[model samples]
Target: MNYPFEKVADGAEETKLIAEEFAEELNGGDLVLFHGNLGSGKTFFVRSVCSALGIDGVTSPTFSLVNEYHGEKKVFHIDLYRIEKADEFENIGLYDYLSDEDAVKFVEWAELFPEQLKDYDFLITIEYIDDNKRKIKIERK
Candidate 1:
């Protein structure tokens, strides 16, 4: 539960750079859960990761709930912000994305269903300190 990999992003540029580097370490079937408040750079990090993985047009899936991308590896960007219950996630087939053996999944607003998300590759927490300052902590689970 200790986050040994922690980075302080002074601005969006640094955050993007961290995400790009983080993307390089990902392999297929990696599950990354993002924990942060709204506008705390969760989506921004996802965008950077997707871009580094050669996926284009990466956007926040707040409304759509899930976004799929095909890059060096298949990637699933899931936003659970609109999800109010665990059953909602199950009903929408979000688990289908996690079941992919050859894909990487990044989930935002993952705190909503912590019980169901105990098993994961990495858990990312982005804490917003100021307008352009964020503390990102990556913990391996």
Candidate 2:
């Protein structure tokens, strides 16, 4: 599907501004799926969002798989980079995070489990254009 909202982030500052604006759309029960290639600034975007939400010390959940933060609203950050199958997702108890009605979810590598996206509200795609350039597309589904 073609996303209606597209923005070019010229650098980290621009990306942070964009992320701050995007975070304004979040509320409880919101799920955001982040799609991007490695080093494409997905984590950077997440950090910006968390910061805007009043959550501090945001980091990639690569090794831990999921990270939870409490701010104006609860935020759940899930990284599925290590998950290769549905069984792995189930084993990790991701459903608990996905079903939490009081938390906003930002899922990285969520494209791995398309079938479990019934509760998702947004899809964000970040594409690398150059060393300091990125194309970010936000779509509602």
Candidate 3:
């Protein structure tokens, strides 16, 4: 399915619904790269996606680098918030996660290492607006 950039300025529930839609349409081996400022609901969107995929308790892997949730499907949530350089992801075994059997990868702060995103399937960008609203864009490049 071709999902153009979608807007979700309604509420948090609306944001989650958008994530659910992406989850339903997403296939195995898909890589989702998230771009936005801090507190822009990147992790929130990821959490909802994981939840929709039958996983639970999706959290940011800030200190741990990566967190894995296992259920009907697996979710690999990677956070590059503390990385000083782009090469740090390689040292953290990014390629291994990518090769893991059909697990979905949700990455935050991806724009910091644009070169690393070449293999990604989709780019999800979320921008916050007034009154608990968010402008979300999901596109394939």
Candidate 4:
């Protein structure tokens, strides 16, 4: 519930609780960048936040590049995992989604293009500690 919050989630349920608390501080037009490796629960964290915001059936946007959801507020979920070039990023019209003023945007693997993602409200890093535990850090700018 605080800026620069850090926690170690022992399992999915604990992660969900943390995400719920984090969601409480969110607002429409906020940009949240997620930094983590593969299978590090980046998408799961976003899903949990979406759920707390009254959205359901949240899934990774790996293939589609982005997913939109309507809840208490509009939500834009984006994944940069499959994108390997700046041109590809531009071709997908991601800039438009990033600039949406009526939606809360969550971008996974944002570290992939730090230069392009200069402005963000929150930066969350999820670290895989083991099969059941993850270290989550959230920083507000």
Candidate 5:
């Protein structure tokens, strides 16, 4: 509910709650960057937010690179996990997705191309605390 929000989720339910609450603050044209290690729930958090936005069947775009969805709002889900070079960004038409002013864009592994992303609405970091617990932090900029 606030910028620089921080919480330690005891399990998946709590994390989903946090994602739903975070989704409330989102709007069209917003860009959200997710930072977390492998198996740290980044995709799950994105899925939760999309679910709160009236979208279903959300899944990771890791292999596909980008997945677009339409619900209450247009959503662009991108995963740069397998991208090896900055040039690959352009090759994947990532610029086109980023230029969509009427969509909410969520980027996973955004930390991999920091220089390519200069403007973002929210930056979220999820750190695994255990098999079931995670520390989630969100910052608005």
Candidate 6:
């Protein structure tokens, strides 16, 4: 479906539906780069993906930079808010995870490494409108 993004309605349930649809089509080795401002529903969508994958207790990796979850497959969710060096990420072995047969990845604040984006399978941008509405666009590189 070309990683098509759909506008999400207000509230968490609607967001879950969107994420579930995305998860239904994705598999291991797929990397999703997320671009969105704070409170733009980035983490919410990630959490919903986790839920769809049968993962429990999904939490933001705001401090840890990366969170690993084991559901249908391993999910590596990385947040680059604290990263000052994009090269340092390579040293952290993020690429290894993405290449792993049992792992999938989702990255937030990925704009820090524009050059590295070509490795991602899809790109996503989320913009907050009013109240709880969000405009999301997903594009293939």
Clash counts per candidate, in order, are 0, 0, 0, 0, 0, 0
Top candidate, metric lDDT: 4
Instruction: Please identify model 6 stretches exceeding 4 Å from their true place.
Output: 1-3
Pairwise TM-score winner, candidates 2 and 5: 5
Error of 6 at 131 (Å): 3.0
Report the lDDT tens digits of candidate 1 across residue range 1-141: 244689889999999998887898798999999999999999999999988989878999999999999989999999999998888867899888878889899999999999988889999999999999999999888
Question: 50-97, model 5: which lDDT tens digit per residue?
Answer: 999999999889898999999999999999999999998788899999
Worst 10 residues of 3 by lDDT: 1-10
Residue pairs in candidate 4 whose N, alpha carbon or C atoms collide under 3 angstroms: none
C-alpha RMSD values across all candidates: 1.9, 2.1, 1.5, 0.7, 0.6, 1.7
Q: Sort the candidates on TM-score, descending order.
A: 5, 4, 1, 2, 3, 6
Candidate 1, position 71, lDDT: 89
- Model 2, range 1-141, lDDT digits (tens) per residue? 244679899999999998998888888989999989999999999999999999989999999999999999999999999988788767889988899999999999877788887667999999999999999999998
| C-alpha-based local distance difference test score of model 5 | 0.95
- The candidate with the higher lDDT, 1 or 6, is 1
Error of 3 at 34 (Å): 0.1
Please give the lDDT score at residue 89 for candidate 1: 66
TM-scores, one per candidate = 0.95, 0.95, 0.92, 0.98, 0.98, 0.89
Q: What are the per-residue Cα lDDT tens digits for candidate 4 across 1-141?
A: 776899999999999999999999998999999999999999999999999999999999999999999999999999999999978877899999999999999999999999999999999999999999999999998
The full ranking of all candidates by lDDT, starting with the best, is: 4, 5, 1, 2, 3, 6
Model 4 off-target regions past 4 Å? none
For model 6, what is the alpha-carbon lDDT of residue 137? 79
lDDT of 3 by residue, 28-88 (tens): 7788899998889998999898888888877778789899887667778988889998676
